[model samples]
Structure formats: C-alpha cells, structure tokens
Target: MIRTTGLTKRYGRVTAVDGVDLHVPPGVRFGLLGPNGSGKTTLVRMLLGLVHPTAGSVELLGAAMPRHAASVLPRVGALVENPASWAHLSGRANLRLLDAAGSGGRRRDRRRRVEEALERVGLGGVDRRPVRAYSLGMRQRLGIAAALLRSPELLLLDEPTNGLDPRGIGEMRELLTALNAAGTTVVLSSHLLTEVEALCTRVGVMDAGRLVLTEDLAALRTPTGLVVLRTRDPARAVDVLGRAVVARSGDTVTVRADDPAALNAHLVSSGVAVAELAAQRRSLEQVVLELTGPGADRVDPGRADRAGPPHQGDAVPVRGGVR
Candidate 1:
C-alpha cells in the first residue's frame, strides 16, 4: 500500500505534481494515467526518493518514505523510465549480479530467485543469451526479471511495454496480472488506455499536475453519451424529440437521452423516416480524454441542457504536462 497527501513538486516556475492525495490499497493492479508530461514519473520518483518533493509526504506500505526509503525499498521492485542493463551480460548473468547485491539468504536461494524471475517474465529459455542479442521485448522482460530478483512485495512499473510489439505487450500484461494476483500490488503507468482498462481494477487520473479522479474502473465508466439518429426530416425530428436534450447537425441528431426505442418509435409514427438509431457510450480513451482535458468542466449528460456539444477538445487533445 502507498499513500500520498497533498504531494507536490516544483522546478523553478514549473509545478510537476500539485496537491495530489492518493491512496493505493494492497492487492491492486493500480493504474496511474496522465497525458505526456503529466508528472506520473515525477510522482513515482518522489515516492521512491529518487526526487524529493517540495512539500507533502509519502507513505509506502506502512512506513514513511524518504525517511524509511532505505528499509522500505528492499520490499519494493521498480522499473521506471528506461531500465538499466549491461548489454554484454547474459540475461541470467544480469539477474545473478543483481541478486547477489540483494541476497534473500543462501546462494541456492538467490539462484532460485533468479531462475524464477526469468521464468515469470518469459526469459528463462533465453537466460543464457546476451542482452544485446535479444529483441526489444526480450530485453524489457530481462529488466523486469531484474526487478523481480528480490521478490519484491510491490512493483512500480512505468511504461513497462513502451517499445514492445503487440505480443510483448500482452505478455507483460499477463505477467503483471499474475504478480498482483499472487499479492504483490503492482502500480502501473501507461499511455495505453485499453491496456489500463484491461489490467487495472482501480485507476487514478492526473491532469495539469492535479489528481482529478481516483476510483474503481467500474464506477468510473458510468458516463454514456451521443445517441445518434439519422432521420428523413432533421428539423421535424428535433421537435418530435420533445424536451429531450438534443443536438442537430444536418440530417443527423444526437441526444443525451438514453432511450432510443421510444424516440425511434415517435419519429416513425410522426412520419419522420428514421434511417439509423443507435445509442453509443464513450470509449475508455474518450472517457479519459474528457476527464483530463478542458471537457473536465462539462456537466453530466443528465444535466446537459442541449447547449453543449456532443464532444469537445478530443481532435487535438491537450497533450502538455505540468512540467
């Protein structure tokens, strides 16, 4: 478990993380999501004591960070930014060296740890191969194996599959999921929305250096929008829509209303030929975009007054970070 209260960091005039209060309970594949430069890495670094925060405090497990970073880190595994590995060393050799530095007891125990880590990340067969000779996916796996060398109870992963192919990404997901299921508590930061939706049970979304939303993935997915309609008379259809919040563009109309069946039936009976009627929900990426961008100021659809656009700011979504 990790918790931060009012955690903040500043460099000159720039603020990387601002007033973020986060609570990550145990046994969760927690996802930290942000646009590029949104301080995901800065927050992670501050948590691990790689960078000191300007204010606030961090607690890892049950102990305070920075003050107890020395003792607490041994129980945590982290792969942040780019992984460091000796290119000339074999996969097993790299892990062996790391395991030697952080022994779990006997030499046999260390070796077993190394072997199990390699197998867990799908690098056991290639342990004998030099890291330079391995593909990007293999090298990524090797870095993860190094992190698991200590059998850490918590894993902090930042873009764990950044350069990997699709298959490699899938493998990384499975490995991380297995680690969490076994009670390791993995904290993941990824730009891949689908990846987060699939692997993370809970998520904390950051925007403009602020922690905007932290909730269970199921509850966070409640916003549905854009009921699409294709009718013969676009103008008449708008009136036939009654008091339902509606948006019209040429022959197509989109409404915030949830029921398409009643609306379709009304339009048909009113002599307004209906071509297509579909009620669509926002995709995970779309939801994230709305939550982080200027649309964050928009009201809920149920409160929408037919004055707001169907969607906004997503064509060229805000891509800047706090730093």
Candidate 2:
C-alpha cells in the first residue's frame, strides 16, 4: 500500500535520506528501524507531505504524494514522534476536535468514535480528564485514540512504545496486533529491537541515510539445533561432546547441531548417555547484528549500512523543491 522510489532529502551539504526505496504490502506490519540521525523521521515526514523531498517520488494507497496528499491522508493516521495535544482540553475533547476538523463526523458520530477509541486504548474511564493531568502512558494512548478516530486503513506510528513501561508496552503490542488482524496496514518505527522482533512481520534496516537490509522475521531467526546420547556415563557424555569446552550444568549437554535427532541416535549407539536432548537457537538481537555487520551491538543496530555500493539509479542527483 506504500511505495517509494529514489526518495531523497537533504539539509545544506548533508543528505538525511538518500534514494530510499521501500515497499509495504497491504495488512503487513512493516518496521523502519534505524539509529538516531538515520533519517527515519525525515522519511516519514516526506511521506506525510509535511516535508518536501529533495528528489524522487512517494506513493501511498495508489496516489502520489503532495499532489494527492489531501485525498490520501484521510485514509492514513499517524503519530509522529510525540503527539500534539492541547494540555487544557479533556481527552475526549481532543478526539472530538480531531474528528470534527479531520473527518467531519457529526456530533453523535464523533462522540461515539471518541468513546470507542478511548475504550480501545484502555482509557474509557478517564475520557473527561484533562490531557495535562494524565500520565505519559495515558497521553500516548490518547494520541493513539486520536489517530484511530477516522478508522484509517493505514496507521503510521513513530516510536509508539517510547516511554511506556512493560505493561504499557504489552498493551500497545496487543492493540497493534488486533488492528493488523483486522486488515489495517501498519508501518512502525522503533528503536527497541525486542519490540520489533515481537511485533513486525517484515523489517527494513536503515543506516547512514539508506536501507541496509530488509527481511521477513522468520528468516532472521537463528536455526535450531538438537543432540542425542547413549552411554549412562556423564563424564563420557561430556567427553564425546567436547567436554572440555562445552559446559554442562545438569543432565543436558549443550552443543550446536544441525540435526538433534540424528545426533541423539548417533550418540546412543556410541555408548554416550542415552537420555533426552534439546535444541536452542540464538536470540533475535544476535541475528540482527550478524546481518547488519559486526560492532552493531555497540553501535545503533537500527542504523542502515549506507556505506555499501549504491543502489541502481540512486547515483542520479536531484534538486530540492520548495517546502
């Protein structure tokens, strides 16, 4: 539902986003992950028509941007960075205003939408409370409610889980999952690797103003391994499986294997412990580092590796337009 070609943005002599090409299919939860100053927010603004791109084109829901932004924006809901909310207004009042100004819903319809949105975000009871009096989590939920007011087909959330506690984060995850299941296309940008691993089906990693890698979540998972044994001697079992280097806390001996069942049968006939065995896979964080290059653990894992060879047609220079 979203596509970009050669999308570039620059400030003075520095390019914040360079020839970014992205494609997000319908109902897919695509993630834009990058470290600070990697141009994630800038790309988002360009997509929303809030910032003019220096070059290239963006299309959303089959319509080109800026020229068709007004027509397309109603179908999209966005919470970029921190939400803009009036401190003095009640939560319900804020949503009501958005409904009126953006969607032009009637009084009764707007009220119902406001109430439903608040309830969806778990803020039904505090709808009457002023936004300033609400906690940060509450305010974040309120922002989400406002974005949902129009029943948008596309939701763009930038760091939606920022500042949220564990409980709040879980709540947000559940909410977004429910939305995607209902056929809403979601594009989320987050610095939290664990959250992305849990929530996103596909991800695009950006660094140095370019996309480094894009992959399905399943493909990124480390392969699982299994092992087997035969002899009852624990010492012999350890010795068979490289005992000196491999550490065994209890009954199980941990070793990397491609086929656990095969290894188990082989060990059983070899006079090793004929007991049970299991397999373990590396975490998502490790896989991410491996794909994006080493030192990613210390550097921002989200940063795209733009220093590599330039993508096709990306070398073509273009001029920036007026805001």
Q: Candidate 2 lDDT, tens digit per residue, 173-248? A: 9999999999999899876789998999998887767877787877766565534333356666777667322555
CA RMSD of each candidate after superposition: 10.2, 6.8
TM-score of 2: 0.82
Write down the RMSD of candidate 2 (Cα, Å). Answer: 6.8
Write down the lDDT that model 1 would get. 0.76
Q: Score each candidate by Cα lDDT.
A: 0.76, 0.75
- Writing each residue's lDDT as its tens digit, candidate 1 over 119-224 gives 9887777746677888877777777777787768999887888778888888888988988888899998877899999899999888767888898887777636
TM-score of 1: 0.75
What's the lDDT for residue 224 in model 2?
58
* lDDT value for model 2: 0.75
Question: What TM-score would each prediction reach against the true structure?
Answer: 0.75, 0.82
